[model samples]
Target: MALFVETGLKPLSANESYLGKKTKSKAYRMYENHLLRVLPDLPLEPKGKMKLTAEVYYSNKLSDLDNALKPFIDCLQKRYLFNDNRIYKLEVEKFIVEKGAETILFRLDPYSQEGDKDYVPHPTDDREHRCPECGHSF
Candidate 1:
């Protein structure tokens, strides 16, 4: 099943939160509030494997991608969209729109794995090729 949500509220950037002050948590709280007001109640089922797609119509082109993504994921977790750990895949894009409402549109899709062969090795592949010239293990 796929779920979609869209909001016109502008998101706080991680850069804005971390630039020079201790306002990260406070900004996140405000962002969360705005999202809660616009978002619908999430479904009760906890998704096991899902891909998240986010399109950010940014009010400012200076906003960092990762910064914009943080509070959104936090808000989703707060509203019980799904466990953060359950998100196996993520896709995010940012667009600059002059004289347009800033917004975030997202979709959650249940991902279907092809097979074990498609799974990437998680550092356990044992291909020791780090620092080959120096033969350093660090």
Candidate 2:
């Protein structure tokens, strides 16, 4: 099932820094509070590898795509009692919309690589590959 949240809140970057202290920003705190009131109860506990697809509607086009993932994923991890490490595949897209129309749509699904013929290797996978032309391993 897909979840939709319309909080009129701007996306907060996880990289926000303050005085060399490690902490969540005020925007993130407000976003979390808003999520607590709007998020629905799940019927089952999510386990194993998972896939997350997020569609973020922002008021402007200047926001970086990568900056939006951390805050939202952190909240989902807290709410669902699951580790973000379990997410094997993540897909995020952002759209520019009018102010006050900012929203986020999320879909979480169980995923497994077993018996899949067309699976692409993740960049962080430990396996080494040999260059076909140079005969070098990277």
Candidate 3:
């Protein structure tokens, strides 16, 4: 049982107890419930349901979570709540297909040009190299 019930959740049952004692708790709960219903459609919610849940789970109130997502939504260009997960997968697949067989970037030394003594050997495959000769990049 949560601390709410462990502490014995009960109706005050009298006008005086409810009006005086339980008012704040009841108001807070109502506000939290209202926020939960509103947060998902807000501008700050993340780009997918799974991402939204993962990103916003930190807040005890949905309003807080929605507020927290503001910077992320701005950084991510407000690409919230994709209707299809497979579209996301397809984006990944497109990048992989376009960059096929490129030399992995870490294998190349950025400062080194062709004849530098510190130059690293980058392994290349059959793909046409649209990247700089230093390494296969996007």
For 33-71, candidate 1 gives per-residue lDDT tens digits of: 988788887554464677778998987989888777767
- Writing each residue's lDDT as its tens digit, candidate 2 over 33-105 gives 8887788876534568887889999997998887778788888888878898899787788999999998889
Q: In model 3, how large is the Cα lDDT of residue 84?
A: 28
Model 1 segments beyond 4 Å from truth? 1-24, 115-127, 132-138
Q: Give candidate 3's error at residue 62 in angstroms.
A: 9.4
Task: Look at candidate 1 and give me any clashing residue pairs.
Answer: none
Q: Model 2: runs farther than 4 Å from truth?
A: 1-20, 44-46, 115-118, 122-138
* TM-score for predicted model 3 compared with the true structure: 0.16
lDDT of 3 by residue, 1-138 (tens): 222212123445335544454433575556445544544443432332222222232312323433433333332332333332212111000112222342111110112135445434554458553434445342
TM-score of each: 0.64, 0.68, 0.16
**Per-model CA lDDT versus the true structure:** 0.70, 0.77, 0.32
Question: Which predicted model would earn the best lDDT?
Answer: 2
lDDT of 2: 0.77
RMSD to the hidden true structure, all candidates: 10.3, 10.4, 25.8
| Order of candidate numbers by TM-score, starting with the best | 2, 1, 3
